[model samples]
Target: MAIWQHGGMPSSKNTQFAVAVHVLTYLAGQVERGPVSSDELSASTNVNPVHVRRVLGPLREAGLVCSRPGVHGGWELATPAEEITLARVWRLLQGADPVLGLHGPNPDCPVGRGVQRSLAAIDGAVAEAVAAELERSTVQDILAREVQGACSVPGQA
Candidate 1:
């Protein structure tokens, strides 16, 4: 389950950030294989096709990916895989949402108000740390790791 789904003050969005990364990494690997339909992407990510399409919208707008139409229609990377950093994807998808979901506690309760303020103060730092760590790697980095046997696929040994 995703953090957003937990009841700390749930977000309206689902796991778009993870889906975007998966879609981009998959596209990078399949670049020479031609466009991949949303069905294919969804199958690989084990996510709904509608959700995959929704995730693609922002990436398409940001020029990270492009799509085709008709019989062979689907998505491909618009930019080089190395140019698409995880930080970039995170910013495009998860930037606006807090690193930790925040709760709207009762204003009249002193303890609630104090806790909310304390948590809010640290949120920015936490978000920055996440982005910084993400910036150290790109989509190509992940692909290369997989190719070099440095990482394992979920279902394969």
Candidate 2:
């Protein structure tokens, strides 16, 4: 499960960000193969094909993936797998946003005046943590370790 799915507030739009990353990562590994259909992705994600298409657009715009039309058409990554890093993926999907945004406090209260500043500091810390983690990971790393582990059997081909 994702962090935001557990009731933790997300700085970015959760569904779009997750879906974009998932779709891009899926594409990154399949570059040598033919385009992957949205229906295939939909089945894996258990999401609607329309939803998958919608999420894929931004990635396409970011030059992460390219889509084809007509029969045997779908999507594939535009760049080499090793060239795509988690930070690139995150920026493509989530853009640059503090992990948490400060909400305005009650204006009449004295504490409210300082609350935004405090939240700004907290947001900075959250952004630093997120950046550090993202920097440490790449999409290829995620694919070789995380996704491969889930799909491959133990001591098997």
Candidate 3:
């Protein structure tokens, strides 16, 4: 459930971030396979192909991905994975979602007003921090780490 749906501050806009990273990382690993269909990306994400396409829209516009139409067509990175920064992807995908949401409590309530003010101050900072961390790594970094981890695990295949 969404954090706001539970009467609390919303969690990070991680769904899109996670899906974008997963899709891109999967793509990075599959470069030799040529353009990958939304269905193929959705398989690893456990999401519908429609949802994958929806996410792909912005990524395509961002010049992070390119899509081909007709048979033997799908999506692929516009640049190498190492050149795609998570921070750039995060900015493109975040849109208007807040890092923290403050439910407008009773307008006349002094405590509610104070809390709102307090929370608002840190929202941008929190988002900045998240972006900074994301900037520290690229999709290629994630793929390398996962591959190395997978290889280290015995009998995991």
Count of residue pairs whose backbone atoms collide, per candidate: 0, 0, 0
Better candidate by TM-score, 1 or 2:
1
Q: Give the clashing pairs for model 3.
A: none
lDDT (Cα, 0-100) at 41 in candidate 2: 78
Local distance difference test, per candidate? 0.83, 0.70, 0.80
CA RMSD for every model?
A: 6.4, 7.5, 5.8
Q: Lowest summed-lDDT stretch of 10 residues in model 3?
A: 148-157
**Which sections of candidate 2 miss by over 4 Å?**
1-13, 96-98, 146-157
Give the CA lDDT, 0 to 100, for residue 139 in model 2: 67
TM-score result, candidate 1? 0.78
As for TM-score, the candidate ahead, 2 or 3, is 3
TM-score, candidate number 2: 0.74
Candidate 1: misplaced stretches above 4 Å? 1-8, 148-157
Candidate 2 local lDDT, 115-152, one digit each (tens): 86888788777776776778776667667765443332
Provide the lowest-lDDT 10-residue window in model 1.
Answer: 148-157
Error of 1 at 66 (Å): 1.1
Model 2 residue 53 CA deviation in Å: 1.6
